[model samples]
Target: MDNQLLLSLTEKYGSPLYVYNADKIISQYNRITEAFSSVKNLKLNYAVKANSNISVLKLFNKLSSGIDTVSIQEVQLGLEAGFYPENIIYTPNGVSLQEIEQVANLGVQINIDNISILEQFGHHYPNIPVCVRINPHIMAGGNHKISVGHIDSKFGISIHQVPHIKRVVENTKMHINGIHMHTGSDILDIDVFLAATEILFNTAKEFPQIDFIDFGSGFKVPYKEGDISTNIEELGEKLSKRFNTFCKEFGKDLTLMFEPGKFLVSEAGYFLTHVNVVKQTTSTVFASVDSGFNHLIRPMLYDSYHHIHNISNPNGRERYYSVVGYICETDTFGSNRRISEIREGDVLCFNNAGAYCYTMASNYNSRYRPAEVLLYNGNDYLIRKQETFNDLIKNQVIIDLD
Candidate 1:
């Protein structure tokens, strides 16, 4: 993105803003589709949990993409964005039976992970075709917090419990239409992901009525310059062949589905904040910005690295400074990072702020959320407006204390 354009956006929309490039998003969506082009049947369900903005969902919908929703609200968003119930898969964890029934009532595909709920749902809605989430017990993600398919994780039905799942299906005559597994996020090793595929295939064999296999996506994107990312082209070549062969052996043409969130939208986002003050402490220099964990929490929450640049002084002499936010507590984004010299009022842009950033934002310290802009075809469109004091107190019931 051009620094001048971001500067203009910050000036027009104010600091602590988020800007998304629509072209990048389209290209990313294309990248995934192109990678699996060899497969006879491919379904890329845009994981709505990553970025549930209506415009973003609509963009995916415009591309004829399906939606993978983790909550009932996401399903609603997908539907409001013009996606049919058949195009949306509701896969949630640790939810109640009522919630599953609620989603099932909507006629969308329901994916049950717990055996208890599976049995209950199977009995209640045996005719409703369902998907099953399996925990392969593989530690595949970069961080334990994001990883949910390990032996001790609580995201999917354990592979050992396949017998129990089979028994439930037999008891209720439930139709199993899909087998699914998501190891975690920020996955780098193709072999590690492929290992989970084998487990999914074995689990699929238990259910002769399955029609699709969903390998939940965790493809890593480049965070910094020259950073390593998942090689989709390579994975495509290998997995497409295996999936085609598997389908042939199973005597059914199955849909190869992937629910990718970060891979589709992470790189297209840029969070722009202006440096409020350049404090030179005795120990370390802090470039305090107008935002904090309230606006972007990945740095403090997951220790994730978001590259920061001094867009206002891009060609100035470089210096090492610790970037901090204005929250009362410690909210350090980066420590001892080298960037072009930053000055008061200089704009600092954080790269890779699309996925899991705004969705996790909160009103901590009673701070208003930043505004969002979408850049499409050389034009900027304001999607979300910055919050006001009215927004802060709208939900609170205040009593007169006089």
Candidate 2:
């Protein structure tokens, strides 16, 4: 992205804004599809939790993409964006059985991860084809918070309980159309992930009526320069071959599905915030920005690193400064990071803000959420508006006591 263009966008829109490149999103989507081209059947269901902007969903719909929703609201958003119910799969965790039934009533595919819910849903809707989420008990990512397939994680049903699952299936006579597993995010080891897939394949054999196998996606994207990321091409090459062989052994063709969130959009986003003040402390210099963790919480929440650059003074001499936010509490984005000389009112751009940044935004400290802009072709479209004061109190009711 051009530095001048980004600065001009801030001048046009405002500081503390999120801008996404549509071309980058399309290319990333194409990368995954091309990687898995060898598969007889492949489905890339864009995970809606990453960035649920209606325009984003519609763009994926335009690309003929399905959706992996975690809530009924996301399913409704997909429908509003013109996606078919069959194209949406609900894979929620710890939700109510009524909520699952509600999603099923909407005709979207239901993926049950708990045995209790599985038996209950299977008993009621035995004819409604469902998918089962299994825990392979394999840790792929290094972070325990993001990795959900470990032995103690609360994400999926245990692989050891396959006989229990089979018993429930036999009793309810429910049709199992798919089997799914999500080993977690930032997956670097292709072999470890492949080993996990072997477990999934073994589980699939237990369900003879399976039509698809969902390898829930947490494919990591590079956060900074020289950062290592998941090798999608290599994994696709190896997994496609193994999946084809498995299909032959199972005596039926099955859809190879991936529900990717970060892999698809992390690189396409940029968060721009203007420097409010440059405080020179005794030991450290703080570059306080107009925004805080309320907008981008990954740094504080997951210790995630986002590459920060001074767009307003890109050629200026680099200086080590701790970039902090205006929040009352300690909201340091990066500590002692080398960035270009930041002047008051200068714009700072945060890279890899496309995935979980804006989606995780909150109105902490009564701060309004920033607007979102989509850069498609040569034009820029405002996808979301900055919240106003009225928005803050729209749902609040005040009682007069005097």
TM-score of each: 0.99, 0.99
Model 1 TM: 0.99
List the lowest-lDDT window of 10 residues for candidate 2.
Answer: 139-148
Stretches of candidate 1 exceeding 4 Å from the true structure? 400-402
User: What lDDT does the true structure give each of the candidates?
Assistant: 0.93, 0.95
Off by over 4 Å in 2: none
Candidate 1 lDDT, 1-402, residue by residue in tens: 999999999999997999999899999989988989999999999999888889989889999999999999999999899999999999999999998888888989999899999998889888999999999999998878999899999899999999999899899998998999999999999999999999999889888888899999999999999998999999999999999999999999999999999999999999999899999989888999999999999999899999999999999999999999999999999999999999999999999988999999999999999999999878899989999999999999999999
For residues 1-402, could you state the per-residue lDDT of candidate 2 as single tens digits? 899999989999997999999999999999999999999999999999999999999999999999999998999999999999999999999999999999999999999999999999999999999999999999888577999998999998999999999999999999999999999999988899999999999999999999999999889888888999999999989999999999999999999999999989899999999999999989999999999999999999999999999999999999999999999999999999999999998999999999989989999999999999999989999999999999999999988989
Clashing pairs in 1: none
Error in Å for residue 218 of model 1: 0.3
Candidate 2: global Cα-lDDT? 0.95
Worst 10 residues of 1 by lDDT: 98-107
